[model samples]
Target: ALVYVVAGAGVLAGSGWWPTAALVAAAGGLALKAIWFDPWLSVGVLLDVGVIVAVACTWPASVY
Candidate 1:
């Protein structure tokens, strides 16, 4: 869910630059919502999860 991304981002922000990824994820979710004709929330859901996974995997724990 999009809320998960926001909440996770908030927590991650407390740690470091991870908050930036969260902001990107949130923007991606919003963009999906705006660009999709049907506006299904699932599009944003996938984007948010993908962003979180991508950031988490690539960034080292110490960096965050």
Candidate 2:
């Protein structure tokens, strides 16, 4: 939740290490969800994947 929010903020501001942070957070969230929360698959998984994709795609090249 916190990671999602921070990533969102990072995407919006395009500052700091938000994009990378978002990617890491989204991956971690997906793993944790799969391992514990929604092991059977759910909308949460889809959302996590979406966040990861969006962050990766929109990540500024300058940041790298």
Candidate 3:
């Protein structure tokens, strides 16, 4: 369901690096979408962007 590529275990442990992992995963997702270029994935693109923005906005408290 929710993507946790780089932060699976970190997320489970509530680690501070989880946000960084999420940013990495979201960036990866956007790259994949660009490479594959599927109209069906438009909504996913928006979500990926959202993750990137949200993590960046909260960076101070997220990835310590």
Alpha-carbon runs more than 4 Å astray in model 3: 1-9, 59-64
lDDT of 1 by residue, 1-64 (tens): 5655565766656755545656576666667676774646776667767766767585545545
Clashes of each: 0, 0, 0
Relative to the true structure, candidate 1 reaches a TM of: 0.38
On TM-score, the candidate that comes out on top is 3
Q: Point out the higher-scoring one by TM-score: 1 or 3.
A: 3
lDDT of 3 by residue, 2-63 (tens): 55655767766878788878888898889999999989999999998988887878844644
What C-alpha root-mean-square deviation, in Å, does candidate 2 show against the real structure?
3.6
**Candidate 3 colliding pairs:** none
- Per-residue CA lDDT of model 2 for 1-64, tens digit only, reads 7887886687678677887777788799788886787556678788779877776676445644
Positional deviation of 8 in candidate 3, in angstroms?
Answer: 5.5
Clashes of 3: 0
Regions of candidate 2 where Cα sits further than 4 Å from its true position: 37-41, 59-64
lDDT score for residue 53 of model 3: 85
Can you give the TM-score per candidate against the true fold?
Answer: 0.38, 0.66, 0.75
Error of 1 at 48 (Å): 7.8
